[model samples]
Target: MNVTLFSKPDCKQCDFTKRGFDKHGIDYVTVDVTADDSGRQKCIDLGYSSMPVVLVESGQEIVHWSGFRMDEIKALAYLEGAPQ
Candidate 1:
């Protein structure tokens, strides 16, 4: 499974998302939308119009969402074989 977090600077929701992932021991890659135009465009292309966008890929399944979602983060922990 692979996780990608698209976020911008000075975003509280993004910070909360990251903290949630950290607390759950979930490893992920971060795409800075503010610093990376292509990343931002990718988020827009994915139909996300928000600051923090999370993309999760596992085998043939792909999941994505926007905003600070601790529930999603916890779900990821379970999916990734981490303690909830």
Candidate 2:
């Protein structure tokens, strides 16, 4: 299972999103779009303009969302059959 979070520095929403993931004990890889070129390109490729883009990928299950969405976060956090 892989969880990726697209974020940037000095972003309040990004901080909120990260804190939420931490609080929920959801391990994830954070991609700083403002720091890395590849990360910025990925955000563009994914058609995302928000600060925190959460992507939960595991085999056939590939779900993603932009900004701070607690509902989505909780869903991914409690997803069954997902490999930790």
Candidate 3:
């Protein structure tokens, strides 16, 4: 399953989310909304004004947390059939 993470720089939650993904050995593509206008527009299109929006492979939103929630993410990953 593919994971798409929409994040912004200097976001502590974003960093923590990355750590969680690393711990799970999950491969994901991160799009920095602050650095890229297109990425920012994507976030807007998704109706998210905050950073660290996580998109799962099934077109479901696993997380839209302003802060990192490792356990929640882990559960969502498992439900999505992603590797732990």
TM-score of each: 0.95, 0.87, 0.76
lDDT of 3: 0.77
By TM-score, is 1 or 3 better? 1
Off by over 4 Å in 2: 80-84
Which residue pairs collide in model 2, if any? none
- Top candidate on lDDT is 1
Model 3 alpha-carbon drift over 4 Å, by segment = 59-67, 79-84
Among all candidates shown, the one with the greatest TM-score:
1
Better of 2 and 3 by lDDT: 2
Tens digit of lDDT per residue, candidate 3, span 28-75?
Answer: 899998788987887788787888877666556344444577876797
Error of 1 at 37 (Å): 1.4
The candidate, 1 or 2, that scores higher on TM-score is 1
Q: Summarize candidate 2's per-residue lDDT along 1-84 as a digit string, tens digits.
A: 899998999988889889877877888999888888888787778888778887778999778788888777777767743333
- Candidate 1 TM-score over all chains jointly: 0.95
Q: What stretches of model 1 exceed 4 Å from their correct place?
A: none
- Error (Å) of candidate 2 at residue 59 is 0.6
